[model samples]
Target chain A: MKLHELTIHEASDLLKKREISSQELTRAVLDRIESVEKKVDAYITIAGETAVKQAELADREISRGNISPLTGIPVSVKDLICTKGLRTTCASKILENFTPQYDAFVIKKLKKAGAVIVGKTNMDEFAMGSSTENSGMKTTRNPWDLTCIPGGSSGGSAAAVAADMCLGSLGSDTGGSIRQPASHCGVVGMKPTYGRVSRFGLVAFASSLDQIGPLAKDVLDCALLMNAIAGYDPADSTSVPEDVPDYTSFSNKGLSGMTIGIPKEYNETKGLDPEVSGAVKNAVKVIEDLGAKCVEITLPHTKYAVAAYYVIAPSEASSNLARYDGVKYGFRDKEKNSLIDMYRSTRTKGFGAEVQRRIILGTYSLSSGYYDAYYKKASQVRTLIMEDFKNAFKSCDLILSPVAPTPAFKIGEKIDDPLTMYLSDIFTLSANLAGIPGISVPCGFSSAGLPIGLQLIGRHFEEKKILTAAYNFEQATDFHKQKPEI
Target chain B: MKITKDEVVYTADLARLDLSENSINRFADQIGDILEYVDTLNSVDTEGITPTSHAIFLSNAFREDEVKESMGADKALANAPEKEDGNFIVPKVINL
Candidate 1:
């Protein structure tokens, strides 16, 4: 295999044996990015020089027998995560030129493990949209079909992994940002349970719903990335003070004694493409064949997930994003003389249409009179949704469904219709609403030659159960082995 | 559930975002449709349920208030659009 094509574990093994230097691996990946970036547009900032420097450092660390599973492996990060001295735009024009003075807790962890930082990938502006077309930066195309979107907010990260621009990448999930894109891009993506991963320096969208996780070529790679990044941090109060398991230790043990739930509501969901449904059904059969018992369960509030999410996510987003006024860092409107005018003008010019729309929606929802009807009501329904997950987990260890209603759509297919675009995330949003861990694993391809994903959701902080199940399925099927011919 | 243009304009003002007349009309329609969709939540029986503001509940994170090394003025103001004398400069906040 080519150097850039190696998974994190594979590359780590080679690096530990002194069979290949980190420099050679990093260069090959950089060369691959340089060659295919125009076709994919998967990155906002390609840190070629820094990646080389980090690789050299990784080589030094490896020679001293200080190698971790991620040591000497090149990986990409979504643009939203703060990286010291590297520009972190969150794919928004407001913070386009802003560079963080400190690394995010996850970035610090990656650096400590000696992983080579490749570059920053593109996403929806402030992670506001399902498709990456909302990104203020360049468009990222699916490597499987250049005409299609690579699924989004984490579009660029998933595309980078699928196209072999990097071994594994970090992507944040807020309402299916990572998993949906990973599904569309035919890669493995996991949204660790909320509070399972610290969000100390993640550019916040919805503080309660956002969690940074991993996107990789397969389930094992996803597990390796999870092991390195998941832990409690005092900096984020929301981070649960629980022990993070050794995610990599979950081997493909045939899923015995496991009971998987298939939500009846999800099976009856509207707009579920037959191809996606077929793929998920096949995945369930595969799990059953591997000694797992499949049962039908109901998350009755599943239909309201998208509705509740739109209100709650935007409501929190408006508050979290209020820090972008002209007083401090990021863009400022120089023409405005008054403080309010500067704030208004700077935001008007700096934010994109989708972002402005969200701000308006959020503000309206949280407005004095409407708060009880919108934000508060949504929160109450959120309570109901959480209860539904709690109830369902009593009967099943994991919930299985299609990651998305359909496979990757064309670039401009749903951009103009925001409501239509929101419905695409129907299958994935409930997990976020309930703060459960979810993984998207490639199960099959559509008749149109696009990949479909099988989503496995576990109770909050039960990442090991889902990872083990996903690994067992991945081992049984060759779907993850099929790479997009970029 | 129809979001009027005036509401969009008013909310934009509240959010400190100035939108164009064209965008105002566009957002009014788009946001109207989205709000109408979100109105589906109105049908759910949520009475007597406590609102969940956060998924994972935790008490206030407390720590010793020790003076630690900060990022410093230089680094903090490094990305500021306008800065001088180790501070960020902005439009005058008060008019005497």
Candidate 2:
């Protein structure tokens, strides 16, 4: 295989045996990125020089027998994660020139493990959209079909991994951002249980729902990345003080005793593409054939998830994003006459249409007299959704479903209709609402040759169970091995 | 659940944002559609269910109140859009 085509585990094995140097691997990946980036537009920044330097340093450490699964591997980070001295724009023009002075906890872990940081990948502006067409800088195309979106706001991360520009990438999931894009891009994307991974320096969208996870070429690589990134940190108060297992250890565990639940509501969801439904059913059959049981389950509140999420996510986003009002950092309106005028004008010019739309919706929802009807009511419904998951988990080890209603659509297909775009995430939003771990692994492809993904969701902090199941399915099917011919 | 343009304008003002007439109208329509959809939550019988502000139950994370090293003035002001004498400069907040 070409150096750039190697998964994190594959490259790590070669590096440990001295069969290849980190610099050679890093260079081949950089060369691949330089060759295909124009076609994919998967990255907002390419840290070529710094990555090579880091690779050299990793090689020195590897020779001394100090090795981890991710040592010397090239990994891309979503632009929202803070990286010291690197421009982290969150794909928003407002912070186009903003660079952090400190590293996010996850970045610190990556550096500590000797992983070379490839670059920052693109996303929806402040993670506000389902497709990366909302990116303020560039549109990230699906490597499978250049005309289609890569799914988003983690589109660039998924695309970069799918195109072999990097071995793996880190992406944050808020309302299906990572999994939907991973599904669209035909890579493995895992969102760990909320609070399982510290959100210390992730640029907040909806603080309660956002969790940083990995997108990789396969489930093992995803597991390895999870092992490195998941852990408690005092920096984020929401971070769970729980032990993070060696996720890699769960890779080879077969599905002999696991019971997978297929949510009846998901199966009966309206507008679900027949191709995706067929793929998910086929995936369930595969898991059953491997000695697992598939049972019908119902998350009765599933119908309310998207509705509740719209209110909850945006309400939190509006409050969190209020920090960017021509203040200490980011964009400022220099021509304003007063403080309030400057705040208004700076936000007007800095934020995009979708962002402004969300801010307005959120503000209206949280406004007096409407709070009880919108925000509070949505929170109560959110509790019901969480309870639904809690009840369903009693009968199953994990829930299996489609990640998105369908594979990636055309780039501009749903951009104009925000409501329709929001519905695309119907299948994936509940996991975030319930604060559970979920993963997307390629299962089949549509007749049009677009990739389809099977989503596996587990109870909160049950990443190992879902990863094991996904790894077993990956081992049984060749779907994940199929890469876009970019 | 029709969101009026006036409501959009009011919300925009509350959000410290300035929207053009076209944007205001478009948002009013778009947000109205979304609100209509989200209004489905009103039918759910949430009579006694406590509002879940967070997904997981977490208590206040306590730490030793210690003086720790922080990003110094220069580093903190590094990304400031406008700064003077190591302090972020903004539009006048008060008029004496």
Q: i-RMS, every candidate?
A: 1.0, 0.9
TM-score of chain A of each: 0.99, 0.99
- lDDT digits (tens) for residues A267-314 of candidate 1: 788899988899988998999999999999999998999999999999
Q: Give the root-mean-square deviation of each candidate in angstroms.
A: 0.9, 0.9
TM-score result, candidate 1: 0.99
The fraction of reference interface contacts (C-alpha pairs within 8 A across chains A and B) present in each candidate is 0.92, 0.93
Candidate 1, position B59, lDDT: 84
What lDDT score belongs to each candidate, Candidate 1 first?
Answer: 0.92, 0.92
Q: How well is each residue in A1-486 modelled by candidate 2, as lDDT tens digits?
A: 899999999999999999999999999999999999999999999999999999999999999999998889999999999999999999998999899999999999999999999999999999989899999999999999999999999999999999999999999999999999999999999999999999988999999999999999999999999988989999999999999898888745568888999899887899899999999889988999888988999999999999999999999999999999767788887998799999889999999989988888888889999999999999999999999999999999999999999878998999989999999999889999889999999999999889999999998889989889999899999998887897
Candidate no. 2 TM-score: 0.99
